[model samples]
Target: TVLYYDDEMLLELKSVVISNCAVGHGGRVIIPTEIKEGKLIIAVLQGEVTVLNTLGERAAKNNMVA
Candidate 1:
């Protein structure tokens, strides 16, 4: 699942498959763009996740703090 927030609203996503995504500010999580100023929280309760950016590069696997 994913969550997003912008200057106007907030969004929550689930069962999403993203390739080359982008995310903006206000906690917005964009798929196929640049991830600007937000936080990505992951909970591996059952499986693992692979995140990719617009550059077709894999996102780092690390704990992040906004």
Candidate 2:
């Protein structure tokens, strides 16, 4: 499954895969969903984004958009 917006993207995957790239210009944040199963991994394939912490505060900023 896949979900996308101007500022967020998420995928529900249980295996490896590759997809085409369609860039969305005009800077926006990207929040990839957290997967509690299978020792969660994250990769920054392109662009920039802002991440928030558990306390609703700024965590990290930039480059985690895929």
TM-score (all chains, Cα) for each model: 0.21, 0.18
lDDT of 2 by residue, 38-66 (tens): 33334433434344232212222233434
The lowest-lDDT stretch of 10 consecutive residues in candidate 1 is 54-63
Which residue pairs come into collision in candidate 2?
48-63
Query: For model 1, which pairs clash?
Result: 5-27, 20-32, 21-31, 21-32, 21-33, 22-32, 22-33, 22-34, 23-34
Give candidate 1's error at residue 60 in angstroms.
39
Backbone atom clashes (below 3 Å) for every candidate: 9, 1
> Would you list the C-alpha lDDT of every candidate in the order shown?
0.36, 0.32
Error of 1 at 56 (Å): 37
TM-score of 2: 0.18
Candidate 1 matches the true fold with a TM-score of: 0.21
lDDT of 1 by residue, 1-66 (tens): 433334232333222334434456865555443432453433212223444332212233232423
